[model samples]
Target: MKKQIMLAVSLALAGLSAPAFADGSGFIRVEAGRADVDIRADGIGNGSDDDTAFGVRGGYWFNPNIAVEGFYSRYYSASYNDGFDTYDVKLHGVGVGLVAKKNFGGNHTGFFVGGRAGVARGVATVEFDGSLEDAEASSAKPYFGVSAGYDFSETFGLSVNYDRLKSGGDGVDVTAETLTLGAELRF
Candidate 1:
């Protein structure tokens, strides 16, 4: 599944590299941030933790105000310690979404605000510190985010974003919220 998503993103990026699409409509972004994860299990106490997170995204602007994007993200392992045992959780996902933005001056360079919505293939893994066995769960979930940024030039920009994502199955439920800083390069 992961491989398939990667291939799709790769193909989309290749398509973006074509000369016909090079009118500053294509972009790639790298993001780093912190993720807060909340976990709830059938019998165990609820747990919450924060960790480092990172992601990469590729997108194409259909116009000055709208675009489609594909992303891959990883939230580093987060650990929760109860009185007698410790649990570590890891999460990663791939998603495609739409972005709608308003540029301050009706151009690509300047302040911008945007909103995004999409669905992601979320995968969650939990490992126990003691004798309990490890478990993994995967599901598709809807995600949404808002972003604000300054475009220093038509080719470069910086942005801050907040996103919410979910993953769960069996007896465990996980919610992840991320605050990220992104650097973008447009071509």
Candidate 2:
């Protein structure tokens, strides 16, 4: 379903008659950055750990501030180490968002902001001694975030954003907050 939505969006973009080569028009963007997770538990007490995450976001601007976007992320090495045992945890998700800007000048620099909503999922396992215990999580969640940046040219720039992830599945429910410093590629 996600793939289909992306494919359809891509096809639509491909079909869009390229807008005049104006300063504030249509363009596509790609981003990568550092991430972290905040795990929330109800019955799964204080026996867990977390590691850093990495993600990518892509957006297409219809104007300076508003565009359609999609994002995917993965958290690494998140787990818990018991006195003599260890548990493993992992998280993955994808979402769609909106991009809007405050500038309409046809320049190469500006500030922007927007919002997003989509589904997210996670998985976990317990590593006891030499054996493995299975646990999994999946959910259809809504996520949102904010961003600010400075464009270097018509095709290069930098930005930063922070987001809170709310998702639950199986017997596990978690929330995470992350700050990212990333590069943007515009086309």
Candidate 3:
């Protein structure tokens, strides 16, 4: 279903007439940074933790102002200790969305903000008295973020962004936040 949606979007983008300001370039972006997951459970205590996270995205600009993007992210595992027990949690997701950007300065060096919605899966494990138990859940969630980049020359650029993924389960609530530095190549 996700692949179908992305293909449809790609075909649609391919068929559109180019806008006056269109760059007519497709770009790929890869990012890596820190991820923080906050957990809340009924019987389990609340805890906040951090780990490594990364993402990759491909997009095409319909014009200088609007674009569509597809992305996949892996938010690394986070471990929490509550004095007597320990918990380990991990999350990953894939999504597609739109971006609205404003190009300023010289050569379209500026910022952008976008929103993405898709499915995410979370796995959590608890260890107590040397015994381990695990629970998992899946959900549809939304992610929002902002980025700033400089288009050096025409085909290459660098960017930094922050994204927050809202995810959870019946008794466990998890939110993953990440800060990423990425390189974009357009062709």
Backbone collision count in every prediction? 0, 5, 0
Q: After superposition, how far is residue 129 of candidate 3 from its true place, in Å?
A: 14
lDDT of 3 by residue, 36-138 (tens): 8777777978988778889898877666566678888888665668787777656777777777666565566544334343333334444343455566665
TM-score of 1: 0.80
C-alpha lDDT of residue 120 in model 3: 35
Q: Candidate 2: where is the Cα deviation over 4 Å?
A: 1-36, 46-50, 104-108, 119-129
Give the Å error, residue 15, model 3. 7.1
Q: Name the top lDDT candidate.
A: 1
Ranking by lDDT: 1, 3, 2
Q: Write the per-residue lDDT of candidate 2 for residues 92-184, one digit (tens) a residue.
A: 677765655554335746655545554444443334545655666666566777777777676776777777676666566766666676676
lDDT values of the candidates?
0.85, 0.61, 0.70
Please identify model 1 stretches exceeding 4 Å from their true place. Answer: 1-24, 79-88, 128-133
Error of 2 at 72 (Å): 1.2
Give lDDT tens digits, candidate 1, residues 65-166: 778898999975777899888998789888988889887954578899999997787889879998669989887788999999999887788999999989
